[model samples]
Structure formats: C-alpha cells, structure tokens
Target: MDKIIKTSKTIRAILKVLFWVVAVVSVVILAAILVALFMKGGTALDGGFSITLGNYSLLLNQEYSSQQLTSLHFMTFANVALFGTLSCYIIRVLLNVFEPMSQGKPFSTTISVALKKLAYAILIMGIINLVLQIATNLIFYNVFDIPSLFNADRVESCSISIVSDGSFIIWFFILRLVGHIFKYGETLQQLSDETL
Candidate 1:
C-alpha cells in the first residue's frame, strides 16, 4: 500500500507536468499559425519550409498557392491541437483518480467517478476523431485530388468507410467495466469501514 501510494503520487506529479507541457505546446502551435497567417507575405511557410517537429517532418519543396498552404497548415494545426487537448483532459482524469490512491484511499468513490469520466471522454473523443478522419479523407481525395492512402487503388471512387477498427469501442467498454469494478470496490471499502 505504501509503495502504491508513493507510485501514485509520482504518477500524479508527472501527469501535472505533462498537462502543462501539452497546453503550452498547443498554444504555441496555434500562435505560430496565427502569426504566419498575419505575415503571409513575409513568411517562408508560404513558399518552402522544412517542418521538423518531434517525429513529423514535412519539406514543402513543391510550389503551392498561399491559400492551399495556409489551409493545410490550419488543418494540421487543428489536428495537433485537438489531440493535445484530449491528451491533457485524459491526464487530468488520471490525476483525479490517482489523488485518492496517493492518499491511501484506493477504493474511494472519487476513483470510480474519475474512471467513469475518463471512459466517457474516451468515447466522445473517439467519435469525434472518426468523424474528422472521414471528413479529412474525403476532402483530401475530392478537393485536393490526393490519392487515398487507405484505399490506394480505389481513389477513383472514394467511398465513406463506416467500418470502425473497434479499438476505441473496445477501450470504452473496458474502461466502463473497470469503472464498475472500482465502484464495487468502493462499496466494499465503505462496508469494511462501517464494520470497523
């Protein structure tokens, strides 16, 4: 129990730092996009810019119109920003669950509630991501005339894919089950406390 509490505290501290880092990085990306938009004539982003951030590297050597480049940047930025925001929220939910565990209350109602919140957040984000992916794919294929990466040969007739990979749905069910298990643990903990 002492070890668990210590680990929980450590994880909570790390999550706090991660939340702030994600928030700051997202804000910086957004600010950069806005600045580029305002300084379109003077910015290299409109012409050829090598974007090497983290694992993503895009070298825009081909000539593209300013509007096309800006649109691409905005879409890319929106995707990154959305992912960062969701990651921060998930971290926050994890922190909430860990707080009680850090205080030696592993089976507290707070943990159950936090688990449920996390489950719901996962479900909501999954649906939103699915929608965005479909929309983005359609736009890239139809508007930009880009070949579909997923359906390489079927680019001539882009069809809407409703088939889910089932990863998110599986996660939602698993988290909900875990939340229920925690709720049962909380009940047992309450009963034990009363008996004592």
Candidate 2:
C-alpha cells in the first residue's frame, strides 16, 4: 500500500509537469499560427506548413489547391491545437484521479468521479480527432485535384488512418469499469464503518 501510494504520487507529479508543458506548447503553437496568418495576410492554406507522409515514389507530392488562404486548412490547424489542449486537460484529470490514491484513499467517490471524467475526456478527444481527420481528407481531396491513378492508390494509402488510435475507446470502457468498482468499494467501506 505504501509502495502504491508512493508510485501514484510520483506519477501524479510527472503528469502535472507534462500537463503544463503540453499546455504551454499548445498555446505557443496556436499563437505562432495566428501570427503567421496575420503577417502573411492569408488563411492557413496560404504559405503555411505542409507535411506529406508515405513513400515519395508512390506519392505524387501532395499539395493544397491554392497558395492562398482557405478555411479548411485553418480549421485543421485549429483542430490539431485544440486536440493538444484537450490532451493536456485529460492529463490534468488523471492527475486529480491519482491524488486520492497517493493519499491512501483509493476507493473514494472523488477518485471514481475523476476517473469517469478522464474517461469522457479520452472519448471526446478521440471523436474530435476522427472528425478533424475526415474533414481534412475531404477538403484535401476536393481542393487538390489529383490524377485518378494517384488518388486511387497513393492518396488512399497515405490518408490519415482512423483505426490506429482505437485503444482510446477501449481505455474509456476500462476506466468506466474501474470507476464503478471504486464506487462499490466506497459503498462497502461505508457499510463497514457504520457496523463498526
């Protein structure tokens, strides 16, 4: 029990530090994007960062429709930055959940509530990421008119995958189960205390 408490405390400390780091980084990135947008006088699609994934040989050098501003690209960057912020929030919630455990109150209602919130946060983040990926892909396909061959093979192969991070959904269910267990434990503790 002492070891568990010590470990939880250590992990909570680490998570707190990581949460702040991610929060600061997310703010910085969003600020930089805004600054670039203002100075460049265009949307994120205009003179913004470009990234391409996959084999260069199979890919046709994917590019956006125009070098001017576009709402789609801006939304993509916003979504990514929002996702980072949400991730930090999730870490903060996890830290909260660990707090009672580190103090040797593992089955408290507070812990259960925090775990439920953490699970919901994970679910929300996963959904938002999926939506953003789908919107970005749709925008990319519509704006950038690639050849049929490249679109059929290379684009499909290189598109952002939705199944890669499906573990979050599983984790959500697990967290809910653990929360219910904690609630039950708390109830048992209450009954034992009353009898004593």
lDDT scores in order: 0.77, 0.74
Instruction: Tell me each candidate's TM-score.
Output: 0.78, 0.77
| Segments in model 2 whose C-alpha atoms lie over 4 Å from true places | 41-69, 148-165
Candidate 2, residue 167: how far the Cα is off, in Å: 3.1
Give candidate 1's TM-score.
0.78
Question: Clash pairs of candidate 1?
Answer: none
Candidate 1 lDDT, 1-196, residue by residue in tens: 9999999999999999999999999889888877665554433434364544359765645444545556556666677778888988999999999999999999988888998889888998888788777766655445444442236664465444555685887899899999999999999999999999
Worst 10 residues of 1 by lDDT: 141-150
The count of residue-pair clashes in candidate 1 stands at 0
Please give the clash total of every predicted structure, in order.
0, 1
Give the number of the best model, judged by lDDT: 1
Question: Residue by residue across 1-196, what tens digits does model 2's lDDT show?
Answer: 9998999999999998998888888888877766655554333343333435454433334333334436554765678587887888889888888898899988777988888998898888888877877877766655554244354754555333445568879989999999899899999988988999
Which residue pairs collide in model 2, if any? Answer: 43-69
